[model samples]
Target chain A: MSASDVTRAIRRMAHEILERNFGCVDVVIVGLQTGGVGLAERLVDDINEIEGTEVPLGSLDATMHRDDFDLRPITSEAATTIPVDPTGKIIVLVDDVLYTGRTVRAALDAIHSYGRPKAIQLAVMVDRGHRELPIRPDFVGKNLPTRRAEMVDVNNDGVDLGEIS
Target chain B: MKALRHLLSMDDLDRDDIEYLLDLTERYVEVSERKIPRIPALRGKTVALVFFEDSTRTRVSFATAAGRLSADTLGFDVGRSSVNKGESLRDTIETISAMGIHCIVLRHFGAGAPWRVREWTDASIVNGGDGRNQHPTQSLADLFTARQHLGDLDGRRIAIVGDIKNSRVARSNAIGFSKMGAEVIFVAPRTLLPASLEGWPVKVTHNLDEVIESIDVCYLLRMQLERQNDAAVPTLREFHHEFGLTTARADRLRDDALIMHPGPMNRDVEIAGVVADRPNAVITEQVSNGVAVRMAVLFVLIGSRLDLVEEQSAVA
Candidate 1:
């Protein structure tokens, strides 16, 4: 995927989000920590451009809610900032890629501690097919079939696929 | 980077480590400010608070920190537990670790208790307050509090007054402050001073009034009457007259100087009652910062290690 392809995908996703939520009212965007933060910010900018209004934006760190916490080494945590009340609002969780669906699950658990939202929807830049959990993205920029050993790198430049080796 | 397994002393951490923990503490402080001041950082993990010595602040702070991180806290009761049945410290620690605890916050009457416990358990050990040896977390919180009030600790003058010989807080704070580029001065009577400041990087002074003007932080350590004998001080009144932070002495201190005490203060003895309540006093802030600092320590020791591993695997 090229830079133009990424931009076109984001524009389409932004339009779909605005259409589904009827002009983005009561809709808040939360980007997952690290990779998803940039995408979430971009989405918020795109949505504001279309709707002529600002959407509540936040960044979530799901490290604490991960199931394999004890099985893996510890990592430095990023900040989780929700500037607005998530209760009675629609939470749109944004991430760079969708792989095992475990991260989305963790995000779901994490958001509960903040406040109970009316609904939560997942948005991803790339939907790589290999989900361990029964999770699906509400807005997908690209559906890229991937092998378990392959890695997907998504950034402003584009999305690139590489093998683990 | 790999996370630390145990915090035996301030020596285990460099300036970077201290700064990292302090920076991480800011995030925890933010978490504390939230409507729900709890995080799932340590969910499904268990921490044991083993206090062989009686404590009110350190013990409660560690427990509260663990709870705030969503970790189950197991309080080891030395009064009613098998410890009273003459069970060895090693055995007690091993028993706790055998129960599948993830971390141990240890406070023992013996110095180096946490270090010795490290040998018996694979679980990470955080030193709460060991016998006149080191209280690394307390120093971390103290540094955090000092930095909050004094801005930067670099080139800051801190005088740790009273009971230097039997203060784990003093030992830890001296190392921590020096590591962070602060100059430490020990102000106490000769009998209260340690016999040797040979390798210790701090100055010694017998006069409180002489150094009060130049110091940025006057950190007062509790006079452990239980730990001292008659030889340590001639009389309480004489000690108060000579080295105590009396109201008159406090008046002589610089307006910007901070008055700090590691609590349960002997009122009008080491510090005047009114002085502790002054605006320059950050004693309460230090207590609150203790929880944040401990939360940072536990998070790094247990949760951050996973992050390191993930980064390494990604690089591989």
Candidate 2:
């Protein structure tokens, strides 16, 4: 996948979010740290281009709030930027890849702690087939079937591809 | 093999883990007091100190401690690191981890920053100091100093003086002392005490004189000037006048009682010079013990079997 693919995904995701959640004029696109944050910003830009209005961009680090807190180590404190009011506003959670659905769950828990959002929608670049929880991405760029043993890394910067064995 | 997995927060460690670390420090303390003080525990290990925030004492002490344990130390000032160029903290950890670093001592300016680093790697990441969050080693050093002077922290009165609201050291110490069965009295101006203190299982006091003499150990905390952005305290002079440990106040304490500071002491601001230098003072001792405590922490988190380190290294 080239950089153009990632760009196209963002553009498509932004349109879907605006069309489905039509009544929600105030929308916040919150990225989950790393790759998700960059994607969220790009999506927000795309959303602005499509709707002819600005959307807020926020970033969150779900390390501490993760259920697998003990399974792995803690991460460096990422700057959590919630630019717009979450109360009664639509929160669209963005990530590079949606695999186990744990990151989204953690992000949702973290967001509630800051403020109450009217609703939340998840958008991901790649939706790998296996999901450990009852979660489905509302806007998915591509559905790449992946095995549990393999790892999915999103190169939103240079190329967009899932690395698997 | 590796030195430490990480020191996220003190709460991450259980009671036995804390004791194991203390016991390790005890052995190192004996070594330091001996004619020759050197250990090969970290002989071939490399400790990388990545501090994104300004920390004079924590950075220096950790480096000195790592050196004493025979570990090669590399200190990275964030002002010069790739972080200044907008490289995320996680990427920086990954970059250092790839360098075959045995341990990473990180002092980040954000609260829970170390925990954040912990998520990124399996290497032992020590929290040099996090922003108004938890400074586990400082508390460990404080506890070590208190125990060294007072024999045991159990049932002893420990008055944590000054800047409770913004001092992670004080917060960690309060919890640590309490866990050790010591009565922790948080002595500070009403403005400086954390609102969370009410939830803490300890007595809080605004008047220093009320709890000062009753305590076996007076733990002086340096005023966190960084909290100046929040105006955490109204005035430094007023804080000193009301809560600072003066020479006159020192006269009232038991002779055997200890005066401890986690240093880079605020000197005239937090503690009087005479008391700070007094025979009962364990300020310097804390610095020395910091290494031992850190060594123990590194030892446990990395692996108890140092022999296996060679095998692990060969495999890597």
Candidate 3:
């Protein structure tokens, strides 16, 4: 996927969030660390343009709460920023790829560590259908049928594509 | 899912269990000196950390040990979660267990809280710490340190001083020390020692100077200001005068005798600064051994699929 394709998909996912939520007042878009935060910021910008109002944006480092942290050392250097009150405000959790849903699980746990959000909805760039959990993305940009061994890399800044090793 | 196998509390660990963990720790301490110090035992396994209290040392050490063995780690702090919103501890643990977490490392401020968590979760539990009742890991590390110094635990005189009744360190150390064939003497004021000592296999004394002179190993426990339940708590100055291991007290011990503390020391309250930093002091060694001991504990409890590592060791 090209950078243009990535932007278009995020814009689409942002619109779906607005349409489903019936507007998004006091709504905050929080991206999971590294690549997800970049995409989340872009989505927040796109959503602001569509609604003709500023939408808050945030980023999170799920390093401390990562399941694979003990297996794989934390590499992300991104900082967390939650601008809106998580309590009673709608939180749109953004991530690059939804695989076995473990990263999402860690991200949710990390977000809760920061503050309590009244409601949290997950949005992802790629819905690689091998979810180990019962979770499904609330706003999915594209559903790519992926094998168990394949890894998806969504460059929220440059190219967005699922690469099979 | 065996409830007893879960190490959510000190009560879960009896004499044999402690011995097994100690034996495993000895093996791992040796294995850590190899060229590549890691095992593949916990591969594809996950250990969740539900830390209600913040701990830098324990968290990092456990994470590093787990990573060396290729196990996944899930850690969460409680402040931002439903835990802060009045969610029951059992409910939180049950939710994580449902996610297929294989093991849990929990630390709480209330005694027996981990037991409550065990009631709701099937994951094998390692009690990082819970209230003032116990910090088994610290004691395990302490035992490892003692074994390293004395070469053996048999016929060793281990003296534990200060905040005897209030300190989980003292409690766990007394049990572990005595179990390992060391004669442990609890040195503290009558007010400090628990009123009832029916089952403890240790001698009680109020004379720090006399006990300090006799022991081969002097383990000083910090006098916890946090645990002082009353405003009439003894002043640090008066406490030190009575029980602190001053330089004068250190001189009373044999030349080869070892001194140790669990860290975050109070200087003169339970131990003197120089004594804690003395050449005989193994406090730093204790901290370093903490990682190795925890590595062994995590490996054994979690079963990190480490047949390859042991096979490699055999060939070496």
* All candidates: TM-score: 0.89, 0.61, 0.61
The CAPRI quality class of candidate 3 comes to incorrect
CAPRI-style grade of the A/B interface in model 1: acceptable
In order, what is each prediction's RMSD in angstroms? 3.0, 21.6, 16.3
| Deviating ranges (above 4 Å) for candidate 2 | A1-165, B1-4, B34-36, B230-234, B306-316
Q: CA lDDT of A15 in candidate 1? A: 98
Tens digits of lDDT, candidate 3, B1-316: 1113565544456666666667666655644553445545567889888888767878877887787666899987897789888888888888889999988999888877877787787788888888777787888899888888788788899888888777777877777777778899988888788778889888888888777767899888878777778632368888888888888889888888999888778997888887787899999888888888887677656563334444546778
iRMSD values, candidates in order? 3.0, 16.8, 15.5
Tell me which of candidates 1 and 3 scores higher on lDDT: 1
- Candidate number of the best lDDT: 1
TM-score of 2: 0.61
lDDT of 2: 0.76
Q: What lDDT does the true structure give each of the candidates? A: 0.90, 0.76, 0.77
Give the Cα error of residue B185 in candidate 1, in Å: 1.6
For model 2 chain A, where is the 10-residue window of minimal lDDT? A68-77
